[model samples]
Target: MRRHLDRIDQLILAELRHNARIPVAALGDRVNLSRNAVRQRIERLERDEYIQGYTIVEHTAEARANVTANLFVYRTDRMRGGEVIAALKSVPEVVICDVMSGEFDLFVRLEAPSVDRVRAVWQQISMMTGVRDITTTVTLSTVIDRT
Candidate 1:
């Protein structure tokens, strides 16, 4: 399906991406539209699920000290698919999960407070039932995090 977004909609999205709490009046001023028009557009976007919801991104001190680890997991068996997914979800350190192909069955992105914590997470994953092998790469720096 092709969803067409006008210039005003694009402006609204761009503004929201920068600051979701910006007032509709300010947004209207920025986009050169009436406040009512901006409000209507925002409502439509929300109703159509284009704009899901507003959220805040907190930068905690602990997070500043943390290191991110990306893990590529190859599973030995497909029979325990649900179990594997459930286990992944149970690990709070696993911040992102995706089912992948090629040499790996799953890819996971995790954050730990320190290198020791990353090592502990790797050990925990190594002990999982059907995980055949795990390859981990530590990110030296993050140039972009669209999320």
Candidate 2:
């Protein structure tokens, strides 16, 4: 069964999403609760799986300058899909991966210094165990990254 969140629980989640490192005292002030109360609520949220562990987003000049590429992969050998996925995960060039339905079995997102580098990565992927066909799209500008 799924659990329903109340208004206070939703408020806590929203505030945490904005800044996970926000101190309990500050969070309490914003939510009109005591520090201990806020802490308890946060703990409950974690226990209930509403709150996952916090993460940090590191932004570097190299990351900002790199070109983002999306690759759509079609696998011929469905049985070897797991091996192909593991190989993709091992490659540092692959930043994101997803198993999809339809023509392509896997979708990958990567960052490279140039378009040529993206092509090289695609070639490497194509040579991997299950990869059959690859199509790529280079992103010109990112309007939104709702991560």
lDDT of 1 by residue, 6-69 (tens): 9889989999888888898999999999999999998888887888877767777755677899
lDDT by residue for model 2 (1-147), tens:
337888988999999878888999999999999999999999888888887677777668766788889999988876567888988988888999998988888889998888888888888998997788888899999888777
In model 1, state the lDDT of residue 135: 93
Q: TM-score of every model?
A: 0.67, 0.63
Backbone collision count in every prediction? 0, 0
In model 1, where do residues sit more than 4 Å from their true spots? Answer: 1-18, 25-38, 44-52, 59-64, 78-83
Q: Whole-model lDDT for model 1 versus the true structure?
A: 0.86
RMSD per model, one decimal: 3.6, 4.0
Whole-model lDDT per candidate: 0.86, 0.87
TM-score of 2: 0.63
Give the Cα-based TM-score of candidate 1 against the true structure.
0.67
